[model samples]
Target: MTTQGENIAERIKAQAVSLGFAACGIARADAAPRTADRLAQWLSEGCHGDMIWMEERAGQRGAPQALWPEVRSVIMLGMSYAPSRDPLALERACDIGRISSYAQGQDYHDVVKKGLKALARWLVEEAGGELKVFVDTAPVMEKPLAEAAGLGWQGKHSNLVSRDHGSWLFLGAIYTTLELQTDRQGQDRCGSCDACQRACPTNAFPAPYRVDARRCISYLTIEHKGIIPEEFRAAIGNRIYGCDDCLAVCPWNKFASSAAVNKAFLARAELVAPKLADILDLDDAAFRTVFAGSPIKRIGRNRMVRNAAIAAGNSGNGAYREQLERLASDDSDVVRDSALWALQRLSDG
Candidate 1:
């Protein structure tokens, strides 16, 4: 005979699937107790780079119960955004700027949060318990929670890897007051595989299960606001938005089918392999118009152009020199500096 908690859990999972979530699992509020200490160590070592938000929310992020004392169970959900094409196909196309698969579609924050809210409402209607939903924006450690909930294990690249979805999952959390039966936790399956570590263009991984975001191309191109350091520019290649080297090379991804991808994450034609020359000329208004509903809009015009300039520099294509010269005089210091670097690189070549 199934217990009341198991029945409720099955219904919740069914509801999550109907709401377009590809994976659903549950865990107690106190699961993954070691996450707090691990997070503290990562912060202390400064692996997070300039993302001070990680440091500020350390206390709440490491533990779910600390964020909400009344929460008895955590529902972890994943939405698939598996790419239909090869994410690394543009590596040799020097004139084209590569955007990460995730950002090639609509902003996931909007898409995922909408689903989370709908699920939260359904849970309230069914169980009559207080609850909260969160996507990536929150301090919640969704990956570890997802692992504790048996969604997947954290691979050596420090990303959640699913046996069913591979590395192409967007995690969300729903904290509820209703007691629910926890699922079996995921076990680390990355026995001897080091493909993800070997594929990093910037050697961002300091060790297994750890990432130094300071050297991460995704962080430099998307998160870090100032002028990118001279060191990682060459390794960044033509990747303007985010890097997919580590994620793309994961052997586990063979099991991830493009058919599992949510429609909301379908890649836009313009973002798939944008021309560096076109991206270099985007003004503020044009940038907003181009990336209106996309995650790339959050980086703003200056950063986008700056990233484009870096890609241009790495391209060794003299065709970008005229645009580089124009951008060298840009108002933003970072954009101007990157454009100058690109111009110099072109001239040197």
Candidate 2:
């Protein structure tokens, strides 16, 4: 060990907390054998679905050595992105849309990665070593690594859940050429709690600790390309972007906090529970204006409008037929098909 190794590690950890990460934990740049095998099995089971990229860096995801040959330690950090209110409550207000808590404000990738890079740069300058930072951008298995590092335990939904922040934390990792003291690993605390599994609108979790991304509403609205499967449409309700049912039902929110540093995390008053009728009227420009600087901007106008059309149809309100009918001729098959489905739901109702 170097003369100042412990001091360096302490400084790094302190600086991370100062940077507003709710919790920080470190692990040796080595693989946990059981976790490694489990990851391989998950890939083989094809649960990742349309996310082909998850398979690309399969080896590096589980083993830090696969990322950098000289990496001596892994520092995993968690920032509590938990909102002050429950996102699930909005679901019962079916006439209004329900955006996942994480997306209610700003895009986390930008904020979390920016903080990680700051800590990384500090390490290079103060510790005399090399470092790399990863947010959600790379092939990092952040949740597993964070769990191994002891920041939190993986809940039944397979997302990392902290006793402090619940399932509302965003995770990032830093790889370094310096050795650091590792944390005690946390155990699975899911117990008999199946709230996350039950809260899922589409039954995405076929079993505990496993999520079928193909059947997840978050996947359908955000990642999965092409028209969503017909069976999931009605169950999707008014969740246009992503679903947070699994995260919200965790019993840990009593200790969770509002993420104050990220000012953009404050929910946009209008977007939080926008009416399906009002959202469906947006053209491309209007959508851009409304969703600018938000994660929803990534999905574009038609996709969002298509979701609104479906929600309108499910609203059992016949007045929205004109708007839904106009979208039926849309060239984008996704929008057109959703319009057709909405029209049918409305007519039948």
- RMSD (CA, Å), each prediction: 1.1, 1.8
Off by over 4 Å in 1: none
Cα lDDT over the full model 1: 0.92
Q: Following a full C-alpha superposition, what root-mean-square deviation does model 2 have from the true structure?
A: 1.8
- Please, what are the lDDT tens digits per residue for candidate 2 over residues 225-324? 6788889999988888888888888898777766433554677787678888788788889999988878888889878887787787778878888988
Q: Mind giving the per-residue lDDT tens digits that candidate 1 earns over 1-349?
A: 2387788899999999888899999999999999999999999999999999999989999899889999999999999999999998889899899999999898999988999999999888887889999999888999999999999999999999999999999999999988888899999999999999999999999999999999999999999999999989999899999998899999889999877788999999999988888899899999999999999999999999999999999898888888998998999999999999888887888
Q: TM-score of every model?
A: 0.98, 0.94
Q: What's the lDDT for residue 42 in model 1?
A: 94
